[model samples]
Target: MRPFLLLLSLAFSGLLAAAEVTLTNGEWPPYLGQQLPHYGVASRIVAEAFALEGVEVHWEFYPWARALQMAERGQRVGTAVWTHSPEREQRFFISEPVVESAYHFFHRKDRAFDWQRLDDLRGLRICGTLGYNYGEPFQQAERDKRLQVRRLPSDELCFRQLLAGRIDVFPMDKVVGFAMLHEHFSAADRAQLSVHPRALRSDPLHLLLSREVPGNAELMVRFNHGLAQLRDSGKVAQYLLDAQQPLSLAP
Candidate 1:
């Protein structure tokens, strides 16, 4: 009787555990947005991947920094749509690559500049989002004073500064930059901005589970397995296509 009761209790606990998994996120549109269908591309892929594993997901949106903090502290299971960094690797178990993004420089059409190498940015006033990791070379250049960087609160602000001629160039994800341009600027204003032909860097984004979370290692395994299945099934590509269609229709 005692053994039977223990087994029943274990089964009930397992059922409760399988009911849901929570993830933290921020408003990074076309990739992850609260108002977006399925909460945008990456979010859709993540949801489908977990669904394949018979797990339900609950997403909590917060400021990017706060979201990362919640995941790092294990206030939630993990944070999605994050780029892997050495520091993040130390604090979290990163899942398989969910998506890749190209980081490119954008400048006013009349202020076109060529970038063959990092050295070309010297003496330029560059704008970037606060708390973002552009890339190793970019960071090193900043530390070595190769260029002057001004950090702003959002991509919209960066573009606003560019239009006002307060900054020379800003680096942003290619897709995100275009989306922001459409969302924040009129047709005439958008026509004045152009992304550099050369990309500064390309990075893969992943879901990062905090080391502080119990059973996180197992969760990572499950997520990767499901993500692999989704990719193998061609669902990943479809999700991206769907995300782009809406943006293409944007005014």
Candidate 2:
């Protein structure tokens, strides 16, 4: 083979290799789920973003904790739709924000409460998802014993406990909480529940690439560029709107 032809073939192979990426995520409805259309909104946005760069994505769904572990160990290129944290920032190369989620406290309609600060949570038994990161303030309060928290395996169980008065309240993403209510409860049951009007916090979710992965920094750059293109083209906004459509809700 001619020397120039050999070089050209190797370059083509490298391009093909760089065009594929594998990612992991858990079932978080309206954001990501295997049964969802386009695998939910954030999934679609990530897909489109990579498509802009001629890259293809292969996604695997696992338990949230397991997925994060796999990504951290470099078993997958990255995981998507993760809330930012100082620990994650130190351990991974995080892409630009992919979605914003409003966290709110939910309780039975008959037991409504309001709070302007974390202090109000004192003496309350709050339910939390076992592997979720609900921001630093909430974690700190739990760690410092300022509030009592019961970690549950799933959101459905937490909602059941809340209704049965076993838990005072539970925090969840506004959309995700509503979707879970609609999925697991009767119309009457749903009507008996309410989310606090005040959001605890609004945090941007990002794709976190494991620092253990080779060339992860370059991959982050590619992802950010593609994400920026998606935003500038108005596709990200459209994806957000579509994600909230009733038809997209999980069963």
lDDT of each: 0.87, 0.86
Worst 10 residues of 2 by lDDT: 242-251
Question: Best-fitting candidate, measured by TM-score?
Answer: 1
Model 1: lDDT to the true structure: 0.87
User: Candidate 1 lDDT, tens digit per residue, 1-251?
Assistant: 99999999999977865757899988877899898788878988888888887678899999888999999999998999888889999999999999998999988878869999999998899998888788889998887888799999888999999988999999998888877777778877777777787999998999998999898888888889999999999989888876666452134
Residue 240 C-alpha lDDT in model 1:
83
Worst 10 residues of 1 by lDDT: 242-251
User: For model 2, which pairs clash?
Assistant: none
| Model 2 root-mean-square deviation | 3.7
